[model samples]
Target: MSDAKLQSVLSSLSQVARQLEAVPSGRPAPDASCVKLNTNENPFPLPTIIMQSAIAALERQYLYPEDDNISLREAAANAYGVSNDQVIAGNGSSELLGLIYRAFLAPGDSVAMMSPGFSFNRKLAMSQGAQFLEIGWGEAHSLPIEQLLSGPAKDAKFILLANPNNPTGTFVPVADIERLLAQSDRLIVLDEAYVDFAPDNGLRLIDHYSNLLVLRTFSKSYAAAGVRVGFGFGHPEIIGRLRNIQNVFNMNVIGHAVGISVLAHRAAYAENHKHIKHERQRVTLALLQLGFSVIPSHANFLLAHVPAEQDGSWWQAALERQKILVAFFPDKGLQNHIRISIGTKEQMDAFLAAARDISGSLKMPSARRWAASGSASALRGR
Candidate 1:
């Protein structure tokens, strides 16, 4: 516990350990009375069958879980029309992403991703001692295809792409993905975390490209995040390697049962997603009418650029006071924007009402600071 010993231990720590900062602790779970919109949790409820299955699973907890999640893998394969060997289950899509780095990344190996991407992609890469490459988002908030196809990017082990990308919720079309595929031989990880809310998925292109890996979760669309189950579809070769780093019992019994139930009851989940998509559009339109240039989204959220008259920091605080929570990015470019998770129509109505009520007296973050942010001008211009 002495300073000298502490310094030595710190020096020996991995780069990821040194770079990783603790998350600002907040409430363990959402306040029961709060309109929780900060995290992109599905505001819908799981079917009664899932609940019953979880309770039933309690009796089996005395036994070891079915290791390697074979049933769930086969179910995912059936859902995606792929062979069973081409799939593997994880505690979450996040752990699968970690498995990629643990399995493939050597000291200098690199993973390419977009600026303002899922932050965990960069964190996971660095933590695994791999280099992380970032290309800026292009016009219309599209992926910078040219940069990704450039010679430098070709050397990366893979590119982490979130179709219906987080925060922005912009999707890269199948044609666009094909363009990337044709130009580069590197592996492409299409993280379709929000694809359930989108028009198309990357799974259709799997037949054409041997280098594609598509990951999906039971969290966002299926409303089973608490279960922490996720899976990936890829060429058997790549999936086999990911399997090597995976723990035998990565997916628990409850997660296995819940995942199977969700796959079987896809229609019920779809119906709820349809409602979320509608709410997304409604909120987007309402924000636009209020002078915010809301980005077009294919996911269950909206990235609305704050008006020149109000700052996201201010709106975030104001909303918090009103028992509403939403995600805010304070980095140079994202400072003036707010990302709102689409909630039930009633929750959204309250949000819109709060915006209108607070508009008159809301004091925004400083204009000078906004002017200093390159993201500010670029996003506003869009």
Candidate 2:
């Protein structure tokens, strides 16, 4: 094939990639010498026992992983109080989402999701040629469940609810979710990636609601983001359909072994959960005292509003200079806000100090240059 023909084939493969490349990288400012809080990761390292278990699996390096990953599935099923047949594990919850989409979404089928939610859901829906019906979460970052059920778009085939939503950290109560389940006919996919840190979890409702699928990840609570182990529970029929669409060797040997070890030492993971819950509250309080308007959160991060004059682009740029990174979005309603992941107490102290320093310097004329330079327009156009 000619070079131009190859280029055309690759271009047709993904137009979203072209659009993504045109936008400026919106990553939190990198920290060369400061505490990192951009990603919502556990500040504490994984326990020694878990590492040893993963190392033990390496001894069987010559053998391929088990086709069904039966041991890991059984452990996960026991942990969630479900039958092994109802559980499906994947490289991450991200892959689980893809499997579910592949199983259920035909081209032109519609999926409903909340706006200002996780960007991955929107991307995944569009990639499948599925129409995304986004319901905008207002100032509170709460899912408009009633509007979703009662709106003209009630014919949506699938709905994704990110409890303790990303970039906003707002949660929908179990009562509200039950209400939604009672009223809607759509398959509800609840992304419970952050539920380990929340006061309540959705595992209990899986058996009661046939249409509900709850996704959990070891990345958040198990402190194994690098290992890439995630599982979802639902009706056995739904899980079986997803399993049919997944690759044969989806779970690597090391990850499956580590997952079993983590399940066995559930108490240690519980302790880590207690520590994170405590620190999350402490960080929220500190940000509130600093005069930043913080959205109520039950997760390991906080969504806070900085000054709103020229959106939050100015504050984002200032933090980059201090090597204190946090997530910021330039969407219409969220333009004045940034999301800060809760880290160790020491890390939180450093972030607060950096925030004070940045606020103090904002009065200077030179500090206002980025805001004046049309960064808002640049962001919007993208």
TM-score of each: 0.90, 0.88
- Can you write out model 1's per-residue Cα lDDT over 87-110, one digit (the tens) per residue? 989898988988987887887788
lDDT of 2 by residue, 74-186 (tens): 99999878999889998989999988777888778888887777777777777677888877874456557778788844777788888878877878778888878878887
lDDT of each: 0.82, 0.79
Error of 2 at 189 (Å): 0.4
Off by over 4 Å in 2: 1-3, 7-34, 138-143, 364-382
Model 1 error, position 362 (Å) = 3.4
Report the Cα RMSD per candidate.
Answer: 5.2, 4.2
Candidate 1: RMSD to truth: 5.2
Residue pairs in candidate 2 whose N, alpha carbon or C atoms collide under 3 angstroms: none
